[model samples]
Target: MALTGSLDAAAQAKAAKAEAYKAPRTAFGQPDLSGYWTNNTMTPMTRRPGVSSLVYTEDEVKKMEAEAEAEVEEGNAPTDPNAGAEAAKPAASSLRPEFAAAGGDVGGYNRGWLDPGHTVMRVRGEPRSSLITTPNGQIPPRKKGAPPPPGFGRGLGSFDSYETRSLGERCIIGFGRNGGPPMFPNGFYNNNYQFIQTPDHFVIEVEMNHDLRIVRLNAKHRTDDVRPYFGDSIGWWEGDTLVVETTHIPQSQGFMGSWKDLKVTERFTRVGPQRVHYAFTIDDPTVWDAPWGGEYEFAPLNGRIFEYACHEGNYALPGILAGARAEEQAAAEAAAAKAAEAAKSKAKDKKAGD
Candidate 1:
């Protein structure tokens, strides 16, 4: 009886402390993370299976942070993947997770270039396995071996070349996991985001491709004909949380060959003065099994999202095609030369036999 009393008192006290730390609200009493916010934590795209669903103990979070710092330190010192076999063990394959499966073998950026951080922010104190809450943090397998997002095909001429390329290689959108059908975070820099709020609307601006998602608060849903880049989004205030449902995503802006039918529902709540808890649920029957969801705590960035001028007609496209054509041409000429040499040898052998 005495032990139970003590436990109840401790629980009440913890709850009281949490309530005290909760940020004071706006004039309308909405928690405000309206400033520039970024989540730079290095939590991987998929959760490690053995990890617990609950937040990490303080000691564990610290250990993970320390490991991340060590990785950064090692990356600062350049090491070659082609170094002696023993030295090369440090450079393991980057293509382990399903995250890399969609991106078939585009190579040569070092681990040093990646800013994926080590410890995720403990929002309300839970250390996350991934932002994903679903069993096995993944986007579910692609159906029927849908060919991975199309790569730049070899071009026959000028017009046929640039128009048919990948969005990222042409410098139009962020590559791989950057400019998402559902806007996934990536290894590259500029993972920052900013939220601007008015009474009637909320705008989320992701730094990749300068993708801006506009949510009409307390507004009517779009009709079926109204397709959009990031899809048409509508928001409503559900208690203190802002729930935004998005649909009608254009095929051009999707991942895993599923933009047309993709549906993303996101919730934003100002949990702390500096941190906005961002959670999203992705639902595309064509792409995922059930509605897989994830959450990440956004840390405050000091400034606004800078310009991301991802232009289309860059020299990179031309360069890539030119490089491919040159290799093909060289191979063709070599084959012809080898055939001619074989014919001459055959003629000499026939004459000697005669």
Candidate 2:
């Protein structure tokens, strides 16, 4: 009887603690969201094949972490310069077979430069396989035979002009959706973000390419013709959550081919002292048959954001144009030489006949 009474008292105490918890507020009486945060995780946007569940069992999580540690060890292994060419081939199980070839020479950077988080994403004390919460754990399929919307710099055909390259390659926006209306982790380094909130505005400063997203508070979106890179975002406080609605996204800066009439709704709520719950929904009738959404949590980081400085040292543009010019000149010379040879053969044949 005494043990039962003790258990009841403990349960009541836990309930009381939960009731006493409250979110911290800003000086202006808004939920404080001003801090440096990181959304880096090993959790993929879609569930891996053969994984039947969204949440992993404790044993499954342990095995996953162990595999990750082994991968990290293999990646950090010292490369032997004297190794033979035959020894450099990629294993069949490698995630990126192209990078594994030639001792990673073809790939831009070594494994040391990559920092796609080591562990799976933990939300509400459970390790999740994917951030996407749909029944299939994947982004909704696009409409049948739906072509990608036309926009500037959409394809890479010729390097005759700078506009042919992607916006991210041109250093105009963050690459791989690092700076987004529905921001996601880049799966590489520089996955940090800094949030600054004011009475009239909220800013999300992305670490990659140093992209900044300025969201107006309690305001309407800009005119439709004035599309921005990350879209025109307007926010309002709903209880402890900051609700953001974004529209007028530039077609060139569309996410997953959902640009035309795309609408993104995001909610940010401080669920714990060090954690912020983030959820976003993608709505575009022209692209997907139905709206799809994902949820994830952001954890506070210790350091401040630093400048990315990408364009200042970029030399690829001039190099690409120069290579194209050389190829064009060579093709023209070959054609001219072939025509001259044909004319000379005709003259020689006429002289022989006379």
Candidate 3:
């Protein structure tokens, strides 16, 4: 009787522990969300053409990945001297439209440094066709009469003071939406981040430009009517997930051409030992007819985040890349001139024979 009672007591204790289980916690006793993470995957933000479904079969994903790899390898390979202009034409079908774009010598020869993700993005082992979860795997169409978002220097900024320049041009922030409420990869490089959690605040140190997103925990929204760069973010813990609602995004930094009334709700949850599932819902009644959102999984960054002190060096690289573009333009012009000369010669010969 004593032995049986002891075994029963042990079993009861195990059951109690299971019922009260909790996720890993920080030293301050909050669910730990502090670490370096990355969301680099081959999945585009919106579904690309030819992708028929939200979730792709393993075989389909493999074929697409293989094709992308092969195309890169071919692009980087040495060109054949005897090959004609036809060699310049893109393949009839491609992994996506961007892959077919002629990125000049810089993108072709310098691809080793680019980390645009090699494998498909998987959520719970299912390879997703895109990060967006809409039925069509795209952003919902804008409302019928939604006004276009205002741009500071889309075209006209030459004569004006330097103040009129775009945020990116001024180095206020880098492009490609790396430091976003719905933080996304730059798609070219530097897709890493360091997340820090404190009792009163949550800070995200973006690798690109060292952009910092400071979230006030359990705080009320500011009503100064002044728009901020990444917007005013306030977060609270809902169980183990950090739920954040952001508003007042600057017009230049709005997501999908929304700003005045844009609101983004983000949820970051620890899903496993090495992964954190990030999801977001975007709401702007004037922009879209309904609230829409997307999701992607984040894994621990392989390396640490280094300080990115950017300033003058940014222009040096763009200038070098521009040289590559100029080279391609000159070649195209020469080819066109040669074709025209050949046509004229043929015409003159025929006229003389007649």
Candidate 4:
């Protein structure tokens, strides 16, 4: 009886300690959210095939992780130049070596450059297969007859001008939505971020392409005409949670065909000393049948952020244009040659008939 009473007292004390825990505050008495954080995880933006549920069992998670590790190993393996064509054929599940190569050229980067996390993202102690939390664990389908989003769905032949290139290829925004109002993991390298807080504003600096997002605290969003990359974000504190709303996303930078009328609301709260809980809801009546949302946890990183200089000394843009011109020149030459051959054959046939 005495031992049971002691155990109960200890449990009560522990509960009290947890109840008293509060996030550190800034000089102006706001919850301090300044830190280096990473959203890196193996969790995909949408549920993968064969994953039926949003949450995975422990055994399922282990199996998925093992498969990912095996893929990493294969990616890191050295290729033999002397190998025959039969040996070069990639597995049906894997990308062709040429496709995987940087710029679709020879001598691509090794897998060491990849830092896709080893494990699925954990939310509330459950391993999640996808970041999206819709009943289907995917983004809602586009409204019927809605026009496809700009920049995509035009097929691969639209590279006639620099403006037709993707935002990432142009170095205007981080690839894979790394800098977003509903920021998500890239499933590749440069998945870190730094959060800097001030009395009246908050800033989130993404590691990929060195993109930055600034949120004005307790302020209204900018006018509708002033669209910005990652949209115009305004934030306010609701108890311990920092609530942010973003709007005015440009049409060219739309998210999954939803940017024109999209509004993203995000909530951030420090749930533990080393973890922050992040949740976001996406609403775009112009695109989706209904709204959707997701939840994930951001863990503190020990290292400092580094700069990603995407455009310095870059020759890819000019090279692409030059390649296009070369193709056009070759096509025109071939047509002229064919026409000349036909004309010569017709003149010879006429002389023979005479």
Q: What is the C-alpha lDDT of each candidate?
A: 0.64, 0.77, 0.75, 0.77
Q: Highest lDDT, which number? A: 4
Error of 3 at 170 (Å): 2.8
Question: Where is the poorest 10-residue window by lDDT in model 3?
Answer: 1-10
Could you give candidate 1's per-residue lDDT for residues 1-354 as a string of tens digits? 001012235445643554465555556656554778777666765667787443455687788788767766755676575776445333334332432323223343444656565566554556665656555555466666454654333223444466666555565556545434355567556788877788778888878777677888888778766776667888887766788888887766665566767787888776656667777777877665566667777788767788887554557666777887898899999999999999999999999999
Q: Write the per-residue lDDT of candidate 4 for residues 1-354, one digit (tens) a residue.
A: 001012235445643553465989988888878899999888887777777777777798898788878877886677687986446433536532222444122444455567867788876556787888876776677888776755533324655898887778788787777788789887667889999999899999899988889999999977657887888899999998999999999876677777778999999987667778889988888777677788888989779898788688989787888899999999999999999999999999999999
Q: Tens-digit lDDT track for model 2 on 139-196?
A: 7777987666454345466677878777877878877667787888867668889999
Q: How well does candidate 2 match the true structure in TM-score terms?
A: 0.85
The TM-scores of all predictions, comma-separated, are 0.70, 0.85, 0.74, 0.81
lDDT at residue 97 of model 3 (Cα atoms): 45
The residue pairs that clash in candidate 1, if any, are 42-117, 55-127, 131-294, 131-295
RMSD to native, candidate 4: 6.9
Model 4, 124: alpha-carbon shift in Å? 1.3
Pairs with backbone N, CA or C atoms under 3 Å apart (clashes), candidate 2: none
Off by over 4 Å in 1: 1-31, 49-57, 78-113, 140-160, 176-181, 255-257, 285-289, 302-304, 309-314, 325-354
Which is superior by TM-score, 2 or 3?
A: 2
Error of 4 at 148 (Å): 3.1
Error of 4 at 180 (Å): 1.2
lDDT (Cα, tens digit) per residue for candidate 3, span 1-354: 001012235445643553354669999888887899988777888888987677777688889799769856755666566766467543546324443343433234134445667778866555788888888887777888887645534524342344555566667777667889788875666778899998999999888888899999999999999988899999999988899999989877877678889999999887666777789898999888888888888889998999776576556335545665687789999999999999999999999999
lDDT of 1: 0.64
Q: Is candidate 2 or candidate 4 better by TM-score?
A: 2
Question: What is the Å distance of residue 15 in model 2 from its true position?
Answer: 12
- TM-score head-to-head 1 vs 2, winner: 2
How many clashes (backbone atoms < 3 Å, residues ≥3 apart in a chain or on different chains) does model 3 have? 0
- Which pairs clash inside model 4? none
